[model samples]
Target: MTNFEKLLDEQLSTLCFKPNEIVEAAVVEVDRHKVLVDVGLHTTGELKITEFMVPPSVGDYIQVVVDELDDGEGNLKISHNEVMVKQQLDDVQSLVENKTTVDAKVVEIRKAGLIVNVGYLTGFMPKRQASIEYVEDFTSFLNQVFKVKILSHDQIHENLIVSHKQYLIDEIGGEIARLEAPVEVGGVYEGKVTGIAPFGLFVDIGSHSTVLLHITDINWDLTKAVIEDFKFGDILSLRAKSVVTSDNGSQRICMSLKHMDMSPWEKAKDDFVIGERFKATIYKIEEETGNLIVSINGIPGVVENKDVSWTRMTNSNLNNVFKRGQEIDVVVKGFENKMGFESIVLSHKGCQSNPWESINEKFKVGQVLDTVVTSVSEKMLFVKVEGDVEAIVHVREVDWINPFEAIKSISSGDNVRVKLMEIDSSERKVSASICRTTEDPYKGIVAGTKVLAKVESIRVNSVHLSVLRKGKKLEATLPARYVNTVSRWLPSGEIEVGCELNLEVSMIMSGILYLKPDNSERAQSSFGTGDNPFAEAIKAALKF
Candidate 1:
């Protein structure tokens, strides 16, 4: 026999030990088949090779429990492997009941489970017990130690199942329970990226657990690229928006990176006040309101096209001024809760810088000079004013013999000198007496003269009369009725927006002259007492 076997025989020669009794053994000679263990008794004990935790070569020390007692000399034989297996089974059962923690190393991988070697024993860590996440590679965890909880054990089948994920969770859960009550709504946390999906990212923050950082939660600038660009191991700071537990006992956490720092609106408050102006560019256009959605830095607001005054231009022309890359000075109008901040009303109208700034710039009121008719329409003729390219005049304002007839004869290439009559910058329009160049028939009529007038329109109790005027406008009354017939016309006649009228000034009050039509052909009747004459005349004429 080997020296170890001799030592085991000598140690057990006097003592009578029973099987299933745990006993301490002193180091002795060890081998592949058996170990000569001095069981600290009168005689040494013999430990079988299969009883070792693993296949021992030599010089390795181990403890074992006696499996059986001898008949004659009463020597004990111990099983080291069986003792370890039983200890692990008891430990795992204790963990399942009390959730105790055990440190274990990954030894080998089998079909559906990991062979874990706890300090005292070996336990099975099935795929389901590995992690909450899916495990793609099992070999990567070889020799790695983890705090594990024994989940289940089968004494009859000699099987053990353990979970490392649950062990961490139970211990961490205790720590989390000791932490403060509820998480603040906008509280921020530092976390690691656990996974990535097309729609969002998942982050792990200790007890904050797997918080979701949606694609929208990323910084506005990086939202589009965050999905494919972010790595699995990236660490990011995020804000917790909400937390809720699911029906299945899983925790859900909503997170945001965009608001992890200061909100853009709050930061914007310091940069832009109520009336401060800034050079802003249009970032986006809203088709519904015809408004430009503009952004300063990351702060967003709108500039309505209607709010901006653009004259002497078309919509397409206005589009050029506020296009994507175009910038303009805008005053911060005001903040609207529903509409955000309103900014400076933009205007492209002529001001001091315009070439028509000088009131006394060469051209006189009656100085008829030659100029090309750049634009001619049915009612107006736009002429290039003097040598000044910026100034122009309408046909009515151009001293012409007969502006109406004269404008018809003029074309785009025709040349004419327009006599400037009035220049009022406040109204932004010019007035000229074109008839001064033509014959003024109205000038010959005295202030109180009874002139022949053609009846142009009929009202409740009077008629609108017209005499040839200087312009295309034939003089007429607004209500076109007798002073007494004002109230009657308000209800009866459906006066249209565009209609012809003629009248004589009955009286002028406050420079606003009152007028009555000259209906010399009709006989006079009592006010409101006679049948509605206009209606009666219409019915008589229709005879329907």
Candidate 2:
């Protein structure tokens, strides 16, 4: 072409390459100081052999970056270490971006986590993310190699973040049956202690699921178990007890270290004497059920609320009265699992003297005793005697005037005197009366006294009245035998309140005023067992 075009072509052909550009180089010759690599240049580029993690042989190819276009000898300056670092950074970036997995080796153990070597850089794996299970001892994992997923990374600072838990999730997936077959329940297996809780020990049984050695299942005598007794990393021979499938379909394993031996359950059955007394050590007081799990003669037993006291103390109150490790006197009652405990049944109050004993000698019928009202029901008053004896006062015996009102008036814990009506030691019952201790309200009232009465309330066969005699109002009831003289058997529903009655009191017996027509001859006659038409009619009515 032209003269200038010919000059430009000669200069362009003489130029070698740009600096910092990555280029693939092949080793042509190796020396002690440097490696001679040809990068398709006129003069071969040189690299320090020390820059390589592994020394290359002749004709080996490696990727390198151009450090300088010229090294004063017309050879290009290149670095294998620098390009290798850059390539690793690119790989770490890809791992971080794609969230991929890579094999890692634990290099150092830190209090917070683990320092691991992944690819060409070191990354931190936090203690919580180091495993699917809790990691209390990191020394077990030192120098251990496992796969991990990149959590975060800083290429500028050469810092990498990884998680062993994430790798386990993606790898193991926690599918116990799919990943590995779980151990058979009731079979013995070797387990390692991973954690220690106050109530139990968390064990690693080589299954994908969890295995726990509960405190209650640790030993027959539960008073000796504490988390401090065991150390982390202690390997134990545990027998699998139960395997429960959770709602999420994962298996939860229950193992016991004590089950490796013959359980005391077999030997305990022959040791119980049905009525013998024993000092029991309380172990666990269940807060929800208030059931006390006790150890008696080194065997587990249960004391229900019913057996706590003859007074029927509730299980809820057992929590308030008893605590773990407290000793109580009890008797071997029986063997039953009524309260969800399959052990000897014990009664705490059975060892004490029965309050019902000698009850007849302490108080006889018609004897007045100072009592405390324990409870008031509609028809009965439950009272407690001085020596923890229970006595009941029927509603009819509460008051001669009004018993319904007396039930409301007598509250719990009220002190009152009661006359014992019946004291039967065999039945363990004390029948009492409140009004019997005092004089009858109808005392000294004559049977033939005439009174102005008013109907207060009617019953099925009698009309109850309030008699105002000499300015004092007194309760009275018309005898059903004499009600027909004025009422002709008045159906109680048709009777009205405040209905005035012009009648003479034929009799006042047992706090009831027997009423009759003032004009009837029977009203004027003696109301007793005599040859009167009224008494004869009463006999005829009774016979009917």
Candidate 3:
């Protein structure tokens, strides 16, 4: 060996390059397989070409790490990949300690999380921390770049975890703060609907904050309000009803769409006048109460069952008379407000002209007119007279003998002639007699006529008898005095049913026949047959 060569060997040994030590080297030669670099030592270090992210040009400075002092090829081996990895570790540690965000590229998708490359270091993002919304398919994130926050970083354990959801939350926090400051109760704002739930609609008021518009506050009618009426991204004008703070210190916003307009009841008095008639649409009928809820000029009003009609038979069921969407004439009676709610009382029957008005001028006693039977009850028959006027035919006035059988013989929609007997305007009642349309049988009977009658019923002081006159059965009351005078004519002192009696008409007044036994023999024998003794006795009894 030469003396200068021996000195070079000793100088190279003094450099003392150790394994895993980082050093800056100058590239001397770039080759296909390896890049030769000068580390300021007598011997040159060679780095694999694959380790250089961007292939280094000759004579360029590059960082390298010592892999071995000698690789048995008379050269020192170095690695560029190791130097890049060490630099990334230092950068990631700084980000974790400072809680900073950096951009990461998704490299691979795993069932539990995503593997991303942040600079030269690989990081793992758990499935739960992927995004603000639930991620079902992680592969959609492949090759996508997102801003991420470092959740943990441990270079020794090689644990580097990052979260994309944390980054989104931090970004939205600034917008939330800006929105919370200006939003106040009772303030109106324009917003867009973001989500729809069964209970309400979620609206995104400006500044990325979402508020709830409950179903009840959406419209005046809750039954007709439906979720399908609204859709996502619908713009609406809303009024903030309340701002509530939850137990978690989070603010909840309640908004309303109905408050955007004035209430109908607030202007009801000005819109409707008492006794004024208007056409109204029936919107709903309460099944339980049978009250009709109608809309008059878009204002809701109520018509109770009693106010539905003038007749008692029609008022019993207002639900069946009025149906949804049916338009009918109604008169506004009055308005009442209770418990922050207003109710308008209306009547459908009052909208028409009163039937009792000028009743005396239109009808007179003993006036016979054809009428249709509207309804029949046990005690009376309801008949419709002129112009929606209804008159009642009482059971007593229905027939002279069997009032119950007469009522049963008549039915609704049957045509019959009735005579007006009484008119009461204050009570709005008209009394009519069906039998009075014909001649009264008692009026035709003379005082001396003798007829046969059957005892029907015996009362405390009177005995009722049924008599046949002109093929019509007539009821006659025989007073106790008359019954006592004819006691020998009866089988016992008490009258019995179906017992025949010989009766003479003693007096007749007010459609009632007063009867006594044929006393012509006694009167003739006592008065000596002068000018018809029965007639004389009747004239004396009636105070002629």
In candidate 2 the C-alpha lDDT for residue 355 amounts to 72
Across residues 1-544, which tens digit of lDDT does each residue of candidate 2 receive? 8989998778777545678888888899998888988877445877888776568999888888888887887656888888877778878777877878888889899888899987557789988778754455788898898888998987577888898776765553322233256557668777766656667877667776447788877776666656678875677898777777878877877787766765466566677779988899998876666567899877778887666755533343355457788999989988863221347888887887777666656677888888678777688877776454667788989987777887888777799999988877765667789988877656656866666678899888888888875444687777676666554312231346787665777776655677766654443332334544555565456446
Runs of candidate 1 with Cα error greater than 4 angstroms are: 1-14, 24-29, 33-50, 53-62, 70-77, 85-103, 107-113, 124-135, 142-209, 214-216, 223-237, 240-251, 261-544
TM-score of each: 0.34, 0.39, 0.37
Compared to the true structure, candidate 1 yields what TM-score? Answer: 0.34
When 1 and 2 are scored with TM-score, the better candidate is 2
Error of 2 at 177 (Å): 12
Q: 1-544 in candidate 3: lDDT tens per residue?
A: 9999999899878678889988888989988998888998536887778776579998898888898878897778888888898888877767888879898889899888999988767889998778754346777799999999999986676768998876865664411234545567778888766556676787667645677787756764545557789875677898877777778867777787876765645667787889899988887777666677887776668888667766443432344346789998998999865422345789987876676677778888878989888777688777887655678888888876566777888877899999998877777677899988876666568786777778888888988887888777776778888776665333234457887677777776655567876765443233212455554554356343
Better of 1 and 3 by TM-score: 3
lDDT of 2: 0.72
Assess candidate 3 and give its TM-score to the true structure: 0.37
Which TM-score value belongs to model 2? Answer: 0.39
Distance from true location, Cα of 402 in model 1, Å: 91
Task: Report the Cα lDDT for residue 222, model 3.
Answer: 45
